[model samples]
Target: MTAEIRLFPCLTDNFGYLIHDPATKATASIDAPEAGPIIQALEREGWTLTDILITHHHGDHVGGVAELKQKYKCRVVAPHDKAAKIANVDLRAAQGDVIKVGGLLARVLETPGHTLDHVSYVFDSEKALFAADTLFSIGCGRVFEGTYPMMWDSLLKLRVLPDDFKLYCGHEYTASNIKFALTVEPDNAALKARAEEVTRLRSENKPTIPTLLGDEKKANVFLRADEPSVAASVRMKGQSAADVFGELRERKNKS
Candidate 1:
């Protein structure tokens, strides 16, 4: 059976996700920005969280892990290299590891960029990707601890997935990302249209997440480093894709 998923806002811009497998009544939270909101969401859905699947060790992502673990004794799962930094992690996972949420299953893909220990979870059967901060809507994460090439390689991993995959990133950064994306691919019709739609959505206080990989391929400038237009925008035309990507990341850092 397909897993039921719920998304809610947490902290200032962070997003919290809940996935439930009805067959076993097993539910998981992708990241815990805070306990009160996650707790409320669990209660509202009548699902007890049995797992806390972390993508990275960022404070906003793991802040409420202690509270949730105490309340439900949920198994805390995080990246192996950084598990010690995250409180209450019961399992340390790396690339190729498969995690079970009741009857549902997800494969871990190590995607380092925003952080060295970053990883993304892909539930192939459900076509859902808990990308966390690695791959956001219309943008990819900043290369903080990792190099630009490392971040570009990490993004390439996701680019190979089926275009229909749904991306559930960790924050509500679409509007701002779109704005920055436009600077690189001003001629992208799809990007322009998506920006207009995102503008309307934000004006209405709607969430702009769970974006389609297909759409991002066409609209996200960070993913379009291979495109001539993006290269031209940064005056790096004819450069290698990695070089173009590095330039784009540099521009966004200043943006």
Candidate 2:
């Protein structure tokens, strides 16, 4: 059976995701921004939390881990390479590790741009990725701990996934990301179309996540850094794709 996903708002712009495998009856929470909403969501679904998957050590991502663990006794799975920095970790996972949530399996992909130890979980059976902050609808996370090359290399990992994969990122930053992406690729019709859609979604107080990576490939500037058009738009023409990616990230940082 395919996993059932529930997306809910948490801690202002941050988001919380719960994935439940019906066959196994195992439920996992991807990054807990706060305990109240996660607990409430679990109660609402009548599902018990079996696992808490963490992407990084950021407070907003893990602030509720302690509380949730205290209440549910759930196992906390975090990045093995950076486990020392994160507290209350029960399992340390890295790239190539496969974690089973009941009958569903998630393959961990180390995506260290937002943070050196950030990891994204991909469930091939569900064609879903809990990307946390590494990737977003129209942009990516800031390069806080990893270098531009590292971030670019990490993003390349997602290229192997099918285009139909749905990306579930950490925040509700699509509207703002679209504004910055427009500055990078103003002439991109797909980006323009996506921006209009995002604007309408925000106008209606709706979530704009769960976007297909195929659409992101066509519209997200960060994902298209290898394109000559994107490189020229950032004045990094004739440069390596990594360099273009760095320049685009710098522009977003300044934006």
Tens digits of per-residue lDDT, candidate 2, 1-255, equal 578999999999999999998877799999989999999999999999999999999999999999999998999999987643788899999999999888889999999978988999999989999999999999899999899999999888976689999999999999889999988888899999999999899999999999999999999888888999888887888999999999999988888
For candidate 1, give the lDDT of residue 161: 93
Local distance difference test values of all predictions, in order: 0.91, 0.91
Best by lDDT: 2
Clashes found in each candidate (C-alpha, N, C closer than 3 A):
0, 0
Error of 1 at 170 (Å): 0.7
Q: Estimate each model's TM-score.
A: 0.97, 0.98
Residue 85 accuracy (lDDT) in model 1: 83
Query: RMSDs, each prediction?
Result: 1.1, 1.0
TM-score of 1: 0.97
